[model samples]
Target: MGADGGTASALEQALSTYLAHLRVERGLSANTLAAYRRDLERYLAHLVASGRRRAEDVTAEDLSAFVTNLRTGDDGGRPLSPASTARSVAAVRGFHRFCSAEDGTPDPAVDLRGPSQARRLPKAISTSEVERLLDASSIGDGAVPLRDRALLELLYSTGARISEAVNLSVDDVDLEVGAVRLLGKGSKERVVPVGSFARRAVDAYLVRARPELAARGRGTPRIFLNTRGAPLSRQSAWAVLRVAAERAGLPHEISPHTLRHSFATHLLAGGADVRVVQELLGHASVTTTQIYTLVTPDTLREVYASAHPRAHD
Candidate 1:
């Protein structure tokens, strides 16, 4: 017999080992592990309630059925979206893969196909809208005006995520070189070049607004501060964008992410390669960055429909 004895016994042992691996070796966050645990628990409960006791007894059809049930099951008879169903399917698949590899059983979940989810395109604002938003930041005079201008300019210039921008420190920005070092998802760092407009706005903020704000907290290294000298929070950054959008006569719902989308779309329109934008955006996969290409194609269609003779019916 192996370390855990029979195949059934080994299945339980393997699950424990896998969970430990996720916690220790992978260093998955508590919330993530909790989510995994919840997903697996629901899946196993479904399997048990359906009279499937052994992990080895699960077939691809059974797994697929579970996904289907998840999609259609509801307390009040409401159906789940393809996206929500996919996440549940992913969780079950992961559990079965662990079972198969560590317990020497076939991975039935591998053959079970997930639900097809419609690809939701990223919403990118037009360049004219972006220009209007930036212009709105400059309407107010004095320190807050400089701060708002710098905040909006930097956001569009770097295409940094809202979190990355607000979390920045003074040391992360080099105005002379027009580069800001961003700490992206998974704590990975990359340096992105800023535009002249952003650089000038930042310089003004540092020389004027920052000093005033920093006085409230002795001295903080954060690039952006509120009335207090402490660094700006993500919530505050979002508010700044919303206020600026309102002032610009744009929709009140415009967010910091809208500026990011605009930045990517505009860059692609100006002939920058998608791969380059992927690196600048700190996306791990080029596929994630390819969504911006859709924006370009859409713009081309609009241009063709509008400008070409005989294009419109």
Candidate 2:
């Protein structure tokens, strides 16, 4: 096929096929697929402009130049941050791998690397702040307030991701056993111990609030439901956390994962083993869980100043 039209169409077809594979076979979420589409589209444009119509025709140098263009804004777009650039690189790499396997195209992106980024520590609120956040969720009256409180409580107590929390069925929770079954990434299941505080709050929600909310819509097995009685979406779950953070007067930007971070951090601080924390967080690797093991500068300074005999000096 010629480089002008045929090659361009081939590249576009490849991208469409790859995206369908991601959606159907890989089971990527809609948000993730959208991001991949955006990044790969940019790459396809660059390749076509450079007269490299076929995936196999591209070289490692072409891939490297594309990375530079992304970082330097040479591709008629604003400069991308390191993190965004890395995500774009990943999309391109994955696309090339798919082409190599399916079409026998050479994968020029195999050795391509994005710029390195510093690893920021997970932000964990103090226990008192956590208490304040949880309390704030319960401030208002009625079923909604009760449901909000239980959502926040369950999230903090189990270290469940917002996706996992919202996806929970009523049967997934076993209050009698003080445990919850969380389905993590790759459909893996892990049962985490529930604290008494969370168990009680969830029980209250189940007993009073859920029944009232359930009456609003068709019957469903979901544990958390919206005001309209539909199953709670990930976006709604995030909104729930955001409203709670505002009411709690928290200074930092609190996302849904903040409670999960605090849950892991506090456990490690309280002498929980790294392996145990790994299982609780449903992290496939202990190294991924080890980030929480890092001692905060504030904690380090406090320990030093108080315990060191000559700290004042």
Candidate 3:
């Protein structure tokens, strides 16, 4: 009930209950929960090392030490980057808050602050550039071209990560309903609406291409396949996309997340709700999707500078 109730076993039990709360009440995905667990593991290690065994026994000084430990390194010479340290500190903070709220344990991490993270704005391709990429992918006429075209279109349209696109099965796509089910990180599955362009491309690939590829691969259920007929690996998908990007004259350094980034940015620029984009992008937190909003202001400024009759040069 208080700091007087101090035991290492009590701390472990409290950590388990807090994690269960995160999973059930909070609906956090598995990967996110794993990260929380990983971060807390370090914090727990720090607690154990300092001989503070109970949630109530943790103090502001202990929380600060945990943050410092995260910044320095964990028994290893390798240092954690600022962002990684920040995430770890955040996990520790959340754990303390959970203990305080649920078990009425004192909250020592309440005033602790994680290191400031450098904001890495997502890079978004212009709409015209995306169009060029799609056109280039579909330009060549062959089974591979057809499949690549579908893949690229789907990526752009649905904002699916490459893994989601590759893991898709024939049944995951509902062309008639204009939707595609994406299996995202943490085993989360989301069904995003497919635009007409993506549907048409997918239809062409399915009708004229997928069967041929599948035949070679012993009836693999994956929607995208390599030349040898196996389910497309992330590496191969990246290579396929690189070829399309080169043909479209896109930058050589363009990442696979480009289309996904562009999708969210464009939607936000077009006045889409942040919450809607969060659902589309399969983000567990709306705050995660809020990054795209940062990309919209430049676009808004461009619109204002170019349009409005009074702003003549």
Q: Between the candidate structures 1 and 2, which one is better when assessed by TM-score? A: 2
Per-residue CA lDDT of candidate 3, range 105-219, in tens?
6788888888887788899999999999888887766799998899999999999998789889889999999998887875788999999999999999999998888888877
TM-score of each: 0.77, 0.88, 0.77
Q: CA lDDT, every prediction?
A: 0.80, 0.90, 0.85
What does candidate 2 score on TM? 0.88
Considering summed lDDT, which 10 consecutive residues are worst modelled in model 3?
1-10
Model 2 lDDT per residue over 60-155, tens place? 888988999999999897789999999999999999999999978677888888899998799899999999999999987899999999999999
* Model 2 lDDT at residue 77: 72
lDDT of 1 by residue, 1-313 (tens): 1232354344455456767777787676565678777666566656555556568788777786677777877322246688877777887777888777767989888877678877776777778888899888878666778888899899999999988898899999999989999988656789999999999999999998888888887677788998867888889888888888888888546866888888998998777888999999999999999988887886667767887999977
For model 2, the run of ten residues with the poorest summed lDDT: 295-304
lDDT of 3: 0.85
Highest lDDT among the candidates is held by which one? 2
